[model samples]
Target: MVDRLRFFLNRIKERLWIKPLAMCLLSTASVFLAKMVDVTEIGQIVPLITLSSIETLLNIIASSMLVIATFAVGSMVSAYASASSTATPRALSLVIADDVSQNALSTFIGSFIFSIVALIALQNSYYDKAGRFVLFVLTLSMFAIVIITFVSWVDRIARLGRVNGTIDKVEMATAAALQRRRLTPTLHGVPPGTHVPGGRAVYGSLIGYVQRVDINALQKYADKTAIRITVAGLPGTFAAPGRVLAYVTADLGDFTDIDICQIEKAFLIGGERKFYEDPRFGLITLSEIGSRALSPAVNDPGTAIDIIGTLVRLFALWCAPIKDNENIRIAECDRVEVPEICLRDMFDDAFTGIARDGAAAVEVMARLQKAFESLATIEHPVMRDVAICHSRLALARAESVLKIHEDIEVVRRLAKFGNSV
Candidate 1:
């Protein structure tokens, strides 16, 4: 259930309306709360503010905020478009979920709603001396919030849609996903050993990407039924109709249709892949950015270099050892099996496209070599071997594309650290 909620929230987070809708509800509640506040006792202590003054302030806010909200929406749409064009379109989701822009827009809309609500209430004589004072205080607080949000939004808006910003966002997302996977390489379950488990294959009904798998729930079900369950698909895998998602082994009998339906619910299928638990998706998106920048029309080798550096940093994180203290092994059910991510796959995802596209660019090739060199130094033997293989592949691509001896020599020198050729 918790994992399902997380999946739901992640999907909702990408929408622009959630924050504004929440803020609107809060604003409406605030207006109602202000009316309930009793100021009769403190009427003598607090100075009585005139209704006209409060209404005038709210009028200004109400009128100006409409334009501000519209402008903010326009700016956000423009940013999304710019990010899609400049970076990979897959990264537009990250830009859309940007906290700064959403918060700023929510503040504008919330303020507008509050002002209009207060203005209407005042015209209806809903507020007395104390209520007017309460409204004034609320308005002041709203103004302060708007001011802070606007300042932060101003700083973020300038870079929100740019290539660098999108790269940074993707890197952060990738790092986070890698970290999560690194900790729980087996998704809170024991690694499945090689064993012949003869059981019925339960398949999903729809064709879509597997967004998330509720491992805990699967484990619980396994524990209850005393059945051995092996998951065939991970979060990033695509599910086809009648495709075997999992294999269930039971000594008594095969699982019923209702039981299969319950088991299938553990896998969350979506229209598109998600990056929250899928590090490969993140790596692929980063590579897409480098591929975009390396295109002839863009001819931006610098961005490709930047992406190489980002990939280097991400792999370094992936290379770090998982602490022994982390509790990834679940004791309840050892039957739930999950596939592990191969270093070779992630390495290929990170560097293959960029290496292919930027083969002719000396700067990109040099950066790619340096990135592998950095990865080679990490303690993990698999990381070293994977980096070494890519380094050689990158050098070979460069060797084929590069015409000048000096350029070939430079790449060859870097290749010495990876392969003999």
Candidate 2:
């Protein structure tokens, strides 16, 4: 029973070894300091006579163990920090683009400091016996190693402070997703009878700026103005993909969990970045323009002539049944009419100028006929609307210009010479 009890006592001591070692080290240091003050004997109070060979041996073992543990912790933290910024990518390419190796350096510095300090403790013991002195030196070296490694554990915890922000962000997103799903899963869905703007089969999900707005009840919830934003795959017929389309207000909570960085991955310049090159979309494609397309460089006067001519012919063609059989010799005065050009410039100059300059109804009507006659071959559906809308908008603006045509000197001069009579 005595032998068994002794074995049990040893096992318990072994189990509780680290705490006792720490206590012994602190106590011995305190006693040494007391002896330095000339107030205590070499073995008085602290560490309970720790100048002994047995105590020196125990100290050496304890220090070695601490350094090993600290080093292990530092290595693990270094690897994790490296992976976080370098390996895991986000839509914002620069999100974690900063240095990953910096964290590893931090662990290295912290552990190094702990190791050196503990090593000094090992070398400076006040023991009288040579065996105990040797043991003290070994103890100091081992303790330095353990302290350095243990410092890494402290570093691992410190590093967590740096990463706590990312964790909080992720948590916020997850919570927002949960809340939106619970409150309104159909928040982004379309209204009755109308699909999303692009007529796409499935819009998956989206976020967009309200470029233009006509909301009746938007003020009830949030801002009533339109905010134009360029989000991924959110289409608008009235707007090109990047064009600001409307003013709108929406739920802030609904947008909270949205990963805007994910959407940026779909673009070369990023969703936030501007267009690197001008895109004519399908308007400038080959089917309409052919290999070499026409452009407005051919003639500036031709739009006014061509637009007016097309309208007259339309009226003539619609009114006179026999005109279909007749070949009209409307001159192609515009040397620059391109294959798919909208002639926004022409409408801006010719039609709007006429309307604004107070041109007579008969004169305005005549010039419009001439402009349409100038380029009568375009017939595609949307492009045709482009022309029609430009003409209409130009005319509206021209009428306004006519009211204030005196405010525009060049317009007044052009208006003076417009009449062929």
Candidate 3:
């Protein structure tokens, strides 16, 4: 339930309208809230604020905020487009969810709504002397908030859609997902080992990517039915009409249609993969950005090189040793079996495209080799092996593509150094 709620909240955040809508609601509420000041004894002591003063302030906000809000929307749209074109389209979601931009937009729209609502109330003579003063104070506070938010937002907007900023955003999101998975690799379930018990395969009715799996919900159902469930459709897995989402082992006869529906509900199938639960998606998106940079039109090896560095940092998170207290892996749902994310798959996602597209670029290959060397030095045997394997693959790609002998030699030397490490 917790996982499901978190996933839902993440999806909600991605919607550009959610914040603005929320702000509008609060703005409307505040206008009515000022009416309570009229009933308070403090209203008698407070100096009377003239109706014209409050009206003039609100008129200023009402006249200007809509235009500012429109400008903000246009700026955000351009930023989104810039992110999609400069980086991978997959990263546009992260760009859209930027808090500063959203807050600024909300403030602009909220201030507009507040002005309009307060204007309507003032026209109707809804406020007493104290209510008018309270409203004036609220208006001043709103103006201050709008000014501060706009200033911070301007700084953030300057970089929001740039290639480097987009890359940083993707890296942070990927690192967070990787760190979460590092702590709970099995999603708090038993590891699906070499052998999984045979059971009735439960296929998803919908076709899409598995965005999230509710392991606790699955465990509860499994406990009720005294069955073991092996999850096959992890997040990022493509699910089709006939694809098996999980294998349900039950002593009873086949599960009813409703039972199957309930089990499938535990998996949230979405049209596109999300970064929240799937770390590989982030890696793949980063790789895509690098590949785009290496394209003939872009031809930006520096971006590709920077992406290599980011991948190294992310992979290091996986290789870092878990704290002693966290070394113990306890399966919160013993009846549910979830396969661990493959190190080989992560390697392929992070490096394969860059290796292929940037093979002929000596600078990219050299940096790639250096990144491999760094990963090779990690103490984890699996990480070392995966790093070595990718190093060889990238070296082979480089050798095949480089026409210059010295360039080939440089990559070869770096590859050899990585191997030795």
Candidate 4:
């Protein structure tokens, strides 16, 4: 239950309106709270603040903040559009969820709301002399906040829509997702045996991607029914009416519709994939950006090369050794069996598109060969084997696509370099 709620809240945070709405509410509350100063002893000792001075400050804030807020919105929309055009549309979410940009816009709208509310309260004579003094102090603080935010926002907005900036955001998100998966390889559940135990199958009601799997809910159901539940649809798995989400190793006669409904509810399906629990989605999104860059219309091999380097760093995190303490599994889900993410699938997600699209570009092919060579050097045998395998595949792609004999030779030499490593 807690896991599901946290997942829900994280998705909510991604919506652009959440921060601004919260800021507006707080701004409105602060105006009323300022009036409470009239009851305090400090209000009696504070110097008198004239109504004209307070009105003038509020007027300045009201007049300027709305304009600034409108400008901020326009700039952000342009940035979003630029990100979608230059990079993959999948990366637009990360660009929109950028903290600095969101906070800056929130500050502007909040300040505008504060000024408007304060102006109304003053017109109604809501504040006494002391209360007016407190309001004056708040107004000055608001000005400082707006100035600082605008200055910081100016710097961030400059790069927010650029290709490099979008790639960086996607890389960071992918890295974080990869790290989380590394820590909890089985998602805190016990790893499956040789094969999933077969029995009754449970299918999802919807046709879409599985965004999250509520393991705790499955565990509870398993424990109550004295059955073992084997998860079939992990996060990122596409769901349809006929697809089995999980297998219940119990008698079909004993299962009820309510029981099946409960199991299906544990898997949250959405129209699109998310980067949170699904690391492959991030990998695929990055590969798409690289592939798009290599498209005929873009013809930018440099971006593709940059993406190769970023993927290398992200994959390196997977090769990093996990401490014994960090490897502890959550024993609470003893009745649930979940499959670990496949290494081969991950490699395919990270490199297949880039390899296919960038085969003709010597710089891209060379960088990819070097990337494979780097991964081959890692201490893990499986990673080394996979790297060598991909190196061979990429070499084959280059041989078929490169028209020039010199370009083929260059790529072939680099591909062989991985074997020597």
Candidate 5:
């Protein structure tokens, strides 16, 4: 089973399917065909037993439309399920190092959001007939809920750095801790500025089109319209560059190679966010900057049995009875061992929108259906089980979505603000 799971995960990792979108178009044709197909199936043996031409046509049209609708919704659910539950192993290097992908996190979050919208829409559906409406949504919602649940697990697939920059920073700090390194030795322990040794420089007696104001040019300067600073970093620091080089505090200087100490006096006290947001933050990923980021090839069918191995690693980490003691073995490639607190955090977050009580369950579930549909179109067994667990336990029992809501403030915050902009 583990081998098969790994093999299956490998087969469709990055496939781009157009089938879901085609469903509506194909269904339209199918609906018309269903209408015509009904004619041959129903023989005009007697006048009373047989319907007239107009009635038969109407019946065919209705049946065909319903079938098309169901087909369209089913295709959508399958697409979402496939993407979320793909089980593709991430980039090999990253897996070995345990570096998580930020892209996957974003995609997971995005898929989550999309699933919510789809589910909401699916639940709100209005079919031509009441029974058809319930059937359409029941089928659609099940698939969609499964998708949302599967995508929820994408975090497990994601690399750590993608979710929390500080996680990697802390790991880097740990490495730094082992070595004898000087941190801001020159800054006298103050929060130090960064180096800009060879980058371009600007001078400023600055002036530019500013937001509409009643002030005159002199008044603008008097009001410090251009925030001026006498910086060793030089003139461009305070002024806009595109406009006639705003007043320069210093004579123009060209960038030149110099000793590290020479540029150390200068600081990018505030500009680093704009300057290095890309390379500093973006360049660190496993994938190259211009290309598609990390794609783990963990799911090869031939080596798929190893997925069970990975699952064992994951499960030992997941269901390990012990906490934080290194006696339990997880993975050979694993660097940092799993802590029980990690699973605590995940399950803590999982209960955010869960339902409790029959009436509330119906409503929250109705809402869940809507949300899951929009965010993703999931339909995996494990995912279905999670939703069903909630439905059976929390909703049926009238317990809070997060059973221990009061005990977990973090979960409460996440639930209340999950949709808040």
Candidate 6:
């Protein structure tokens, strides 16, 4: 339930309208509340604050903010287009969901709505002396917010659509997902191991990616029914019609449609995979960027080399165990089974695309070999083996692509090192 709720909240936060709508509600309430306070009662104690003064200020803000909002929208559209053309399309979502840009636009639009509401109330004689003072103070505070937000937005908009900026955002998101998975390798459950005894398959009704899994809810159901549920497909796995979503083992009775539906509900199926808790998707996006960089039209080896370093840092973090303070402790069922992400699969996702597209690029291939060698320094045997395998694959591709002996010799020397002296 926590994982699913986190995923849902992330989706809501990414939407461009959610923040503005929230600000609108707050703006409406502020206007109404200010009007309810009778300012005349406190006029003698607090000096005179005229409605005309506040009204004039609001009128100026109200008129100017509409144009500003229009400009902001236009800027956002241009940024989106720039990101799509320069970076991989997969990264466009990160650019769109940028908090600085979204908050700036929301602030502009929200301030406009507030000013308009205040103007309407002023024209309707809704403000008493004290009410006018309250609105005046609120408007001044808003002005500060707008100025600060605008400055930050201006600084951010300069680079928000750049390829490097987009890559950083994806890397940040991926690192967060990887950290969460590190804490809960089995996603807060024990590993199901290879198979389940007497486990019957539960098929999915739709065809899509498993975006989220409500493990807490599933555990609750398992406890109630005294059954063991093993999740065959982790988040980011593709599910087709009648494909096995999970396996159920219980002595009570056969699986009913209601039970199957309940299982399906725990797994949030979606048209596209999400980066919320899917590290694989993040690696895939990074690889996509590398592939795009290596394209004949782009022919940017530096970008691909940069991504090699990024993947190395990510894998290093993944190899390290979570500290006691860093692990998120929560109540989870012991009967439920989940599959941990395989080390080899991550290597495949992070390297294959780059290898395929960057084979001929000596700089990229050398960097790729160095990255695998770095991962080989880790203590895990599986990680070392996977790194070695990918290094060999990359070396072979470099051998076939490089017509020059010097370039091939460099790659061969690095591969021979094998992550050790």
The lDDT of model 3 is 0.91
What do the candidate models score in CA lDDT, each in turn?
Answer: 0.86, 0.33, 0.91, 0.90, 0.28, 0.85
What tens-digit string does per-residue lDDT give for candidate 3 at 1-421? Answer: 6666787888888998999999999999999999998888978799989989888989999999999899999999999999999898999999999988998999999999999999999999999988999999999999899889888888988898999999999999999888888888999899986785577888998989999999999999998887789999999999998889999887575565327777999998989999999999999999999999999999999999999999999999887888877664578999899998999999999999999999989999999999988988888889888889999999999989999999999999989965366
lDDT of 1 by residue, 1-421 (tens): 5546866787788999999999999998898788775546755567889877787778888888899899999888999999999998889888998999999999999999999888888889887677778889999898889878888898999889999999999999889888878877888666777886458888999799988888888988887877778888888888998778888887467565328887899898888888888899999999999999999999999999988888888988887666677544443447787768889999888899999999999888988898888889888888888888888899889989999999999888877886531
RMSD of each: 2.2, 27.6, 1.7, 1.7, 24.9, 2.0
Report residue 239 deviation for candidate 5 (angstroms).
8.6
Candidate 5 lowest-lDDT run of ten: 274-283
Task: Give per-residue CA lDDT, model 6, range 1-421, as digits (tens).
Answer: 5666777888887788999888888887898898656734664565577877787778877888889889988998898898888777777777888989989998998899999988888889887777887888889888888889988888998888888998899899999999998888888777776654357787888899998887887888887777788887798999998678888887476455236677778888888888988999999999999999999999999999989999998999998876767855553768788888998999899999999899999889988988888889788889999999999999989998999999999989989867463
lDDT of 5 by residue, 330-366 (tens): 2221111111112222221233223221122233333
Off by over 4 Å in 1: 1-5, 196-198, 252-258, 323-332, 419-421
Please provide TM-scores, in order, for all candidate models, with all chains considered together.
Answer: 0.94, 0.19, 0.96, 0.96, 0.17, 0.95
CA shift at 33, candidate 5, in angstroms?
Answer: 22
Q: Tally clashes: model 6.
A: 1
Which candidate, 3 or 6, has the higher lDDT?
3
In order, how many clashes per candidate?
Answer: 0, 57, 0, 0, 38, 1
On a 0 to 100 scale, what is the lDDT of residue 416 in model 5? 37
**Model 1 residue 196 lDDT score:** 64
Ranking by lDDT: 3, 4, 1, 6, 2, 5
- Summarize candidate 4's per-residue lDDT along 184-269 as a digit string, tens digits: 77776788889746888999889999999988888888878877888999999999999999998863446653378889998999
